[model samples]
Target: MPTTEPARPAHHFVAGIGAGPANLSLAALGEDLLPGGLPLFERQPGPAWHPGLLGAHSRLQTSWVKDLVTLVDPRNRLSFLNYLVQTGRIYAFLNAQFDAIPRVEYARYLGWAASELGTVRYGTAIHEIRFADRFELVGADGPVATAEHLVLGLGTHPEVPPCLPPGGLPGVVLAERLDATLAGDSGATGGQVIVVGGGQTGAEAVLSLVRRGVRDIRWLGRRHWFAPLDDSPPANDFYRPAYQRFFHNLPDDVRHAYVGAQVLTSDGVSLETLQEIYRANYEGYLRDGRAPVMILPGRDVVRAGARDGVVTLWCRRASGGSERHTAHLVVLATGRRPAPLPLSAGLAELVELDGAGDPIVDHDYSIRWKHAPRHRIFVQNRGRLSHGLADPNLSLLPVRSAIILNTLLDRPAFTIRDEQVYTMWA
Candidate 1:
């Protein structure tokens, strides 16, 4: 069946390009402040924050207090706490005693907020955005809606390495499809499985295979060890507004160096997730006399291929040697790259690009464009170097959205009061 076109509002004050958590955060914050409202244009039929990757044991790395509106507007009606209260799940949620909320529960919280806002036009795909007196959001079907301002939150997608064959190998799959692919004769239970990447997704993928009775699994990562996320106070200060403010004022080289130095803080697996994996492996060993998962750190999978019933992976070890591993299925959890923005050629020509042909996002998250003064194009999750690791971190979602809102609204819509700060960045 074909996807039917949903009705658009004809026009909006701000036409958010994607309805992911970033734009959803914007809609949550700047909806009332804008003239008409910051409505979202989502390609998906419904609200789903990483629907495929929400494993049974996945938990958020950030705190629950870092919700859609709390850090920026705690009194906002669409807060996670408010969602809990309105849905009659507050007491039940509190009773669970979770150090970190389940990723599924956070997704549900986002969906609930999206439902309450009712500002998202789902199933509406924006392919190319062209600029005129205003911006026109063009969809696959046709030009859908025009807006005075545009915000890009296209979000990220699974990154399958180039070493893999085109369209992926026959039995090879991304980490998100591991479970379903396992059911399809991809050989999950009967043979060894290969999981690439050491991030949270890869960790979950390895654990999932163990749960599914896969006795042999090779978990490969480029790091010296499977590092855990540094969620400590000084480390978290790297996510604060004070740190961002200081970091932004530094030279580009310094900012880049700082981000490179602190990659694990934002990108590493959760400590709890690692502990679970170790405990599960220990239990499996006690029961079956053989550990289910083989944790191979310092191995980077540089090439992969599939033939007959086996998926072969050629990894480049950090200590400078190559090794091969053949498995029934290869799960590529190699992290995600940001989805390409739908900027038209004309719009692209107008926007300033960095040396690498990426957008030159400023301190305020606005892309430096020719018509930025009159018409603005703000982005989310596209600035890790310019901004810090907090550019894409969920813990700073509301704060980042608040910064963008303040830029878009041309006034301080939300006051970010980060007064009590002891650490001073040199």
Candidate 2:
């Protein structure tokens, strides 16, 4: 059936590209500040944040206080707390006493907020964005809307390693589809299952396979060992607004070094998650005489291929030599990169690119373009190099939204006050 186009306002002061948490945060914060609202065009039919990746036991790494509006506007009606209250789950949530709330609850909170905002044009994918006197957002049919300014919050997609076949193999599935793929096929987990990628997602995939009674599971990682997340106080300072401000002012080389040195802070597996995997492995070994998950760290899969329903991975060991591993199924839990912006060639020509050929994002998260003075093009979650690690993290969602709003509004609409700086970057 053909889907009906939702009614649009024709022209907007500030329009957003994607309705993920990034743009959702922008919309929630700018709800009252913008003349109408920072309306968003989402490709999805409805509100969902990483729905496929939200496993039953997966808990959010960041605090729930860092929700859409709480960090900036706690009193906002679209806050997580308000969502809980409205849904009559506030008391039950508190009584449950979780250190970190389940990822499902957070997804529900976002959907609730999106419902209350009522400004998102769902099922509307912005195919092309061209700029004339005003930025024109075009969809499948034609020109969807025009805006004075645009915000890119398209988020990211799961990345599969280039070692694998371009079109993909017979049994190779992404971590997001592991559960469904396993459930639908009774023999999917009958033989050796290899999970690639050393990050938190990979950890979760291994654990999920273990819970599903898969006896042969090989968890491969590129790092020396599966490291725990650096959740210490000093490590967390990198996520603060003050540190973000400080880190941005440093030289490019220094910034890159800092990000590389502190990779574990944002990219490592959660301590709780690691412990749970170990405990599960121990108990499974006691029950079945052999461990279900084989923790194979320091192995970087350089190449992979499939032959007669069997998958073979060629890996380079960290210590030195190369090795081969075979499996019936392979789950790729590799990291994600920012989705490319759908900018027209003419508009892209006007924008300045950095040494890496990416857009040069300013301190306010706006791309440096020819018409940036009058018409700004802001980006969210696409500034890890310039803005530090917090750019891709959920910790500073509201903070980033506040900063963008302050710059877009051309006033101190929201003051980003950060105090108690114990560590100096000098």
- Once model 1 is optimally superposed onto the true structure by TM-score, how far is the C-alpha of residue 148 displaced, in angstroms? 1.2
lDDT of 2 at 94: 98
The true-versus-predicted C-alpha distance at residue 358 of model 1, in Å, is 1.0
Best by lDDT: 2
Could you give the C-alpha RMSD of every candidate to the true structure, in order shown? 3.4, 3.0
lDDT of each: 0.87, 0.92
Which regions of candidate 2 fall more than 4 Å away from where they truly are? 1-9
Assess every candidate by TM-score.
Answer: 0.96, 0.97
Candidate 2 CA-lDDT value: 0.92
lDDT of 1 by residue, 271-328 (tens): 8889988998899889999888999999988887788888888989899989999987
Number of backbone-clashing residue pairs for each candidate, in the order shown: 0, 0
